[model samples]
Target: MVEPAHPKRRRAASWILAVVLAVFVTMGAVGCSPSLGSPPCMPPEYRVNPSSAKPGEAVTVSAPDATCNPRYGSNAQIRIVFTDAMGVEVLNTTAPMTDKGGFAFTTEVPTPTAVGEVAVYAAPEGVDWCDDTGTNNRAGSGEDELEMASCAKPMKPLTITK
Candidate 1:
């Protein structure tokens, strides 16, 4: 075997790399942990003001801004959907994010003048849930945030009487 000339330098470089990786793991876990909630993994949430309103009344859908964490890819353009008591889609629109995560859109509640309940829910922005792009293919080990978000999230519900 040939003797290495810079063995000391090689060891020093390895030590530095290890330290750097350790720091990264500690600092990055806060944003990437599988846990869900605010300050970390705040899942997308939505609500409508005045749970009770008249038909065709003005209403606001809020998908409040969230922590732009790197681990959980919650970057989808939040979609605001208002449906009738029968679960029929009444109003459908996409809300734009103000800063990082949360989004909001204002719309009027619709109805057929039925004296029943109305519902408002949310979902990911795009129609197709599958991502074939290299950036979001959580098919195997070592998947990115965007890929993990491909799965559907529990839709937030808001009930308002008209």
Candidate 2:
């Protein structure tokens, strides 16, 4: 006659299986699983043509790889901002994201009092929802934007030459 397994052993094995299953489920949920209906989280990129420019010169800034799906959803606008070395907002404008989440616009470089470097930053504004980060906090709480929007601020370096 064969002996039956001990009650304690059976309970331990069941507990271990439960824990392992839970871990796998959590991992899949957190992982970047495209099948889970979550788009890959990619920071919107900024592109500057003629990166180095003289004051009053026309410069074009574009973001051709920005996407709003699975986070901001449709009907989101990407705002382009130009800030001087002193952190002063010199120019600001908004562009509608294309179906492919890209936009292009031209603006004259701001002629600051002194010739210095100006930074170009872009972020999605007026988003419908913002996703929680690894820390479980709202991601996009900032000035002039939705509190829950993802604050993926991609920047481009620009030099103002004399």
Candidate closest to the true structure, highest lDDT: 2
| CA lDDT of each prediction against the hidden true structure | 0.56, 0.66
Give candidate 1 misplaced runs (Cα > 4 Å).
1-25, 32-43, 70-76, 127-153
Residue-level lDDT of model 1, residues 47-123, one tens digit each, is: 77766677777777676554544232444565676666676777777766543346667666665534456666664
- Candidate 2: worst-modelled 10 consecutive residues by lDDT: 129-138
lDDT of 1 at 40: 31
lDDT per residue for candidate 2 within 13-110, as digits (tens), equals 99999999998798666644445455355435668998888878999887765443334434656778888777888888887765445667788887
Task: Report clash pairs, candidate 2.
Answer: none
Candidates in order, TM-scores: namely 0.53, 0.59
Cα RMSDs, all models: 9.0, 6.5
Q: Model 1: which ten-residue window has the lowest total lDDT?
A: 132-141
lDDT of 1: 0.56
In angstroms, give how far residue 155 of model 2 lies from its true place.
2.3
